[model samples]
Target: MNSKRSTEILVGLFVAAGIAALFVLAMKVSNLGDFTDDKGYEVVANFQNIGGLKPRSPVTMAGVRVGRVTGISLDPDTYDARVTINIYRQYDNIPVDTSASIFTAGLLGEQYISLSPGADDFYLEDGDVIDLTQPAVVLEQVIGQFLYSTAEGD
Candidate 1:
């Protein structure tokens, strides 16, 4: 009876540990919209080249995530990317002079949008356009530039 009770306790402990492990895995891998509170309105920004920038990429200001890229499409006439950003409404106080820049994690890392807020009392309203936007930098283009520069130096 003593040996049986010990084995049961060990089994229970292992089961509890497994359950905890699964919970942690889900938290890490799931895009549960876990980090954001979308208390803001959506706005559009057009870019001539949105290279490798996909939906759900973070829209950050000064390295802090403020919003996300909600949608992407092409303009009917100019063929430019129409990127829709959903910012938290409380931060709608972001000035109209805010500039958007596409940045990478590293030379061969993921991409996310960066926002640079400018000093201006005027802020953006719903449906407003953020005209100052940058597009993602393509890796191939960077490699090409490196090769060309190396050849030139040689």
Candidate 2:
């Protein structure tokens, strides 16, 4: 009876460990594990359309992640979508003329902000707004345009 009880306890422990490992894996895969406060500088950019971009979306420069979107709001004055990004302090050398564009990881993957550096000598500072921005591309609009053109040509 004693040996049987010990075996049962070991099995329970093994199951519990497996469950914990799975939980950690889920959090990491979903980007929930890196929930620390943004220890970086904030910059704003306005877009005519944002599509499905949400907070916490990655901001990449040369295909390397440099920051994350911290907030997204609508500007009542200009009726534009205002996106706030928190850039890591280490990437402080981004030029003032750098351009930001919304892009997808894959054909139908999640959207993220991509930054292209410019030749300007000045660097962007905290709270500065990026004037050069490209809005997200909506796939539906492209398809609609294609269908309309094809029907017209027929």
Candidate 3:
């Protein structure tokens, strides 16, 4: 009877540990593990191409993380990709002429939306569109251009 009780306790402890590990893993995956926080506001920017941009991807402004992408969709009239992002309320001083550009983290890393702020005194509203946008740079096109230029030079 003592052996049986010991085995039961071991199993229970193992199960509890697994549950705790799973919870930690989930929090990390969803980026909800952090304690200190600030509220943000949702805003949308349309793009001609939002190549491989995933939800929760960082939205950067002048090399700083201002927010993250909340959602993405398609426009019925323009067929462009509409990317929705949430900017922290404290960082909501973007000018009206600001533009968005799709950028990759590295040569083979993940992609993110980079916002380039303009000098306009007027700020963009919640639903305002970033008209001056640049799509993701095609790597293949860049390589081809490089090869073509080298051959011409030779």
Best by TM-score: 2
Model 1, residue 78: C-alpha shift (Å): 1.2
TM-score of each: 0.72, 0.76, 0.73
Query: Residue 122's C-alpha lDDT in candidate 1?
Result: 96
Worst 10 residues of 2 by lDDT: 29-38
What RMSD does each model have against the real structure? 4.9, 4.4, 4.1
How do the residues 1-154 of candidate 3 rate in per-residue lDDT, one tens digit apiece? 9999999999999999999889878687757753237656778888888889988899999889988998899999999999988887788789989899999997899999999999999987677777888988878888999999999999
Decoy 2 TM-score against native: 0.76
lDDT digits (tens) for residues 1-154 of candidate 1: 9999999999999999999888777776776535445557888889888887889888888888878889999999989899998886667688998888888877767788898998889998888888898777887888899999999998
Candidate with more favorable, higher TM-score: 1 or 2 = 2
Question: Which candidate, 1 or 2, would have the higher lDDT against the true structure?
Answer: 2
**Models sorted by TM-score, best on top:** 2, 3, 1
Better of 2 and 3 by lDDT: 2
Model 1 — which ten-residue stretch has the worst lDDT?
A: 30-39
- Model 1: how far residue 18 lies from native, Å: 16
Model 1 error, position 122 (Å):
0.6
Native-structure RMSD, model 3: 4.1
